[model samples]
Target chain A: MVEVKLFASLRTVAGEKGFLTDAASVGELLREAAERYGEDFAKRLQIATVLVNGKNIAHLRWKRTRLKDGDVVSLFPPLAGG
Target chain B: MIGGYMGKVLQVDLSTGAIESYSLPERMLELYVGNKGLGARLLYDLLPPMTDPLSEKNVFIVTTAPLTGAGAPSSNRFNITTKSPLTGAIVNSNCGGNFGVFLKRAGYDSLIITGKASKPVYLKINEEGVSIEDASELWGLDTEKIQEKLTAGTGKLVIGPAGENLVKYAAVFSQERAAGRGGVGAVMGSKNLKAVIAGGKKRVPVAHKDKFKDACRKWRQLSREHPATGEELPRFGTSIFVNKCNATHTLPTRNFLHGSYDEADAVSGETLAEKHLIKNIGCYGCPIACGRQVQLHGKNIKGPEYETVGLFGPNLMNADLKAIIELNYQADLLGMDTISLGNTLGFVMEAREKGLIKTDLAFGKIDRLSRTLDDIAYRRGLGDDMAEGVRFLSQKYGGEEFALHVKGMELASYEPRGAVGQGLGYAIGSRGGCHIAAGYPIYLEANGPITVDPLATTGKPGLVVLNQTTMEAVSTIGCCIFSVYMFLPKALLELNARSPLISKIVRSTFLYGGNIIGKALSWPAWTLPVPAPFFMLPQVQTHAHCTGERYTLGKMMELGKRVVSMDRIFNLREGLTGADDTLPKRLTDELQRAEEPRSKVTLSKMLPKYYNFRGWTPAGVPREKTLRTLQIEEEPMLPQTAMGAASTV
Candidate 1:
């Protein structure tokens, strides 16, 4: 099981702050999430930052990066400020 | 006057009650531009080196840029450059307030205030002349009250009790916004000046009226189109960075003992917008409207910015957003800088925890905070020590290692360990730990449209140099630095987010491009002649159109470089050295998380590279060749005695 946390506009789009899921990898978790949150959320996720264990997934293996039980995933829409 | 300037600068010398006007040399205007750069030049020339910041000798300058009142979006801002009692270094505080616009409208581009008044007084400037009015009734009033008591339909800048008591971080309020750092309000209060108000019917002259207007319209449209400035900022305000910074392990928590806070999301911009925000507000000509108006205690008041929220919330271990909101309002009304106030309180809390000092203040308990703020403002009890600022308090008590300040100014919300580039920024920032003066490099390192490796020290120096130069040039031209958010446009962000390979390429480009940009900055300004594309950097285009000057990206970069070097000279003159470019031991030696070995600011690795990139000596002093290249001299002219006066007060 993995804990998925959403922030910024992503939380509002997902209709929840977080959820517990049994997806085996980042791809599995996100594909399932896309189905649950809808096509609009799927589109939004294209522009959202996905972090696993506090590390940005872009530096990881992208969606191919694996997830494990107790691993935490956080998603944020692109943001900027001083 | 070419354009935008009122062609006169009022020099108000309270010691002799003389208000004189002088037309700044045209070469100086072209070289320094206006606002921060101009103010820096004026301060450097008018006040002797090593002058006491709180003494009658310190000079206070208020300067507006050409775009201040020229109907440009995000361009109506003013700057206050003065010697600061807090760091004893140069302080150039910029504010997105209407005072700059009104001052321009009142037929002056700048005001130079010097010396102390024998009694409490306020200065009024309008179409007819200037007056130093007795301000006994306005004295000791809160910022809001004093501003309210002022004449209506005019721009006002006022200080409250914190300033009057000489609290080191006291801020001056113009409307609800603040010129909010480095004891500017204390300088004002030291002069026994309660307020300064300006009003008039003068119109700002634009050299190319039609072109300037069109460029401004397009600039506003562009701001609305950019993802960061238009959508996210307008919707979330600055607090949106909370979740992003937390995810990146850059959020300051528990007085810098930790990075992420469990309660961070509770005080995030999303939470503020959902729970407390009444509406999004804008400053003067700002189209981004990142300011927030929130509901507090059945009344609506100015909401805390991200700095206030981060430092007061997670840094102090307080999850109560309502408390932060109330404290933010309280700090503003009391006319103290919330950034410094928050850091000071956090230091005290940790000191209390370690038994280093005895105080009622503690982390996660804010019950006494309101009264504590009052006490600090009034300089009563332990608040007297707190009024001396974190640097002084730590020196007097114990715990200097974790005091969380550089050169006396408190660090901003981004805990530097998680983003080491920002750590370098804080260390070498001209104004000593100021986020803006450090060029807001956290944007490039952590939460920008693109992200570079947070732990790498490879190209950070060059990146920091570019960011600082860009931010300085933006401020020099009188635009809100938020407009630079469009430098990373929507198309690039969407493309970056959509493709992992492209994102990698973009990040690598910035990472390595930093080195190239840094090297390029050392080359003669004339070597790069291309104007940045209008679509990409509309600010340069708008400035050229407004002022009818030939402005390219090269000139803008050069202007920024000149300002940076001038500040460095000013600091060096004030006895600051390369040794002063430092962060607290807590940030340098301690990791944000024990498990993350790379989560510490490696300042030593970046400092030499930064100095080299700026063409400065390894000691961080500007070389004589560089000074000559920038045309910064040892002296500039100031108006003489009474006859130079356009009118006397």
Candidate 2:
């Protein structure tokens, strides 16, 4: 099970804080979450930043990065302000 | 006449209670655009070298851009340009308030205020015209009370006791927003001015009403669709960066002694929204609604921004969110800049810990802060020296090494050591240590989701220049700087996520292409005739339509370049040299993280390259060819008034 967290607009689309998924990789987990949410959520996720245990998947293995039980996956839409 | 402009510039001589109006030239409007650009141009021409910033000889100008009050979203920003009482450099403080909108309604593109008033007075403007009225009763009052006493419908800009008492970091308040940096309020107080009110029934003229409306609608839609402007900002406000910055190790802590805080989440935006937020607010005609109103003492009031939170909260090792909210409101009512105030307090705390100064204000001690803040506003005891700001305190005491300021202005909450490019920005920023003026490159370096190597010195000079030029252009056109966040659209962020190779390539492009981009932008407008994409910069199309002017992305960027050049020239004439463009020793000489050998900013490694990219001499002065290309006068005109021998401090 992978623990997923949503932030900003992604939270609004998901309609929940996050959920647990049994997907083996980040891409599979995201696909499952997208199905549970909707096309809008998937569209937002396409542009969303995926962080696995505080590391951006872009710096890791993109969606192909493997995940295990207890792994915390965070999804965030592009955010900026200061 | 431009559709958005009132076509008049009002000049008030407070010494004689004389009011004069002059026509704003079409050529000046085309060249400078408006707001920051126009204000800089006016200051360069009118301000005499070496004139005391708080003296009657100094000129104060408040200006609005063409989009202001033209019903453009987030376009109500007004710029206050004056010689800074704190830094002695030209300071242009921008505020998001209704005053600019009402000033446009009251029939002026800009207002030039000079000469000290004979007595306490406030200037009133309405459709009936302008007049200087007695404000003896309003003197010494808090900002909120003063605004309440003014005419109900008029837009008012008022100062609190802090400004009246001439605190070096005093701020001017309009509604709840403030033009809150570089002692602009002290400049107002020095003139014996209390407030300025603008009210009228007139509407800003539009050149092509249909086209202008269409452009504005598209721009608004773009903002609404963007995840940043549309959702994140409206939901979380600017304080949303707290957790993000903390994650990136960019949160300023312990007087910038560290880049990360152990308990940043306790005072984070998520906590504020869940525990305190009453609702989100916005400036006039703003779609983002990025302002927060939090419930405190059973009443809702303006909440702390990211800068205030970082400086007042984690910087001092305090995690009390409620206390920060209360302090934010108190500071606003007192008309003091929270950024400077917080930085000053942090410095004092560190000084006390180091035994350099005798004070009970220790780290994480929150109880005495409220009283200390009040005392600083009223100039009581230690508060008096504190009111003089960190520079003065460091000068008098022995904490020069940890003063946490540049060019006499306190650095903003972004701890630069974490983002080396931002450090370079703080050092070379025109208005002392302003993050916005420095282009806020930390968004790319650390804060934003997509980022570059935070500790790298390579490619930073060009990055800073690019960000600075783009930000200056955005601000000059009267739009909120937040609009620039959408420039990196959802598609780009998505593209980066899909492929690591693409992300690296894109980041490399930004890093390496920066020098080429900066150099090309430094050239004259004719050399780069291609217009910036409307989707990326909707301001150009909207401005062109509203003013009936031939505006392009190249022309807008050129105007921004010219504004920066003129400001540098003003500083040069005022006697500031290249040596002044530097950070505190703590940022450059000391490391933020022990293990990360490159935690300190390599400012020397970047400055020369930055200068070259900007087409400036190695001494950081603009070259003759550079000035000619930007259409600025090669040499500044002689001071109209007798300026004594320049003081090179």
Docking quality (DockQ) for each candidate: 0.62, 0.52
For B1-649, candidate 1 gives per-residue lDDT tens digits of 6787889888898877887677888878898889999998888888877888999888889999999988888899999999998999999999998998999888999999987999999999998999999999888899999988999999998999999999999999899999999999999999999999999989989999999989989888888877677778888899998888888888989898888899898999999999988998989868788999998778889999999999999999999999999999999999999999999999999999999999889999999999999999999999999998999999999899999999999999998888899999999988888888888888877776477888888889999999999989989999888888888877787788766788888888888888998989877779889997776789998988888998877888989999999999999999999999999999999877888898899988999999998879999999988888888887564545422331232
Task: Mark the regions of model 2 whose C-alpha exceeds 4 Å error after superposition.
Answer: A1-43, A50-60, A64-75, B634-649
* lDDT for each residue of candidate 2 in B1-649, tens digit (9 for 90 to 100): 6667898888888876667777755767777778888888888777767999989878888999988999988778999999998899989999998999899889888888888887899999887889999999999899988999999988888899999999999999889899999999999999999999998878889899999999999999988988788888888778777766775667899898887787886887767777888898888779888989888878878889989999999999999999999998999999999999999999999999888889899889999999999999999999999999999999999789999988899999898888999999999989999999898888888778687777888888888887888889889988899988877876677778778899878787877776777677667777767777777788778878888877767787787788888889889989998999999999999988787899898888999998997889999999989888888874433232211111111
lDDT of 1 at B230: 72
Question: What docking grade does candidate 2 earn?
Answer: medium
Residue range A1-82, candidate 1, lDDT tens digits: 8999987777887888989999888888888889999998888777777788877767447778888889999877767665
TM-score of chain B of 1: 0.98
Worst 10 residues of 1 chain B by lDDT: B640-649
Q: Please give the distance, in angstroms, between residue B401's alpha carbon in candidate 1 and its true position after superposition.
A: 0.5
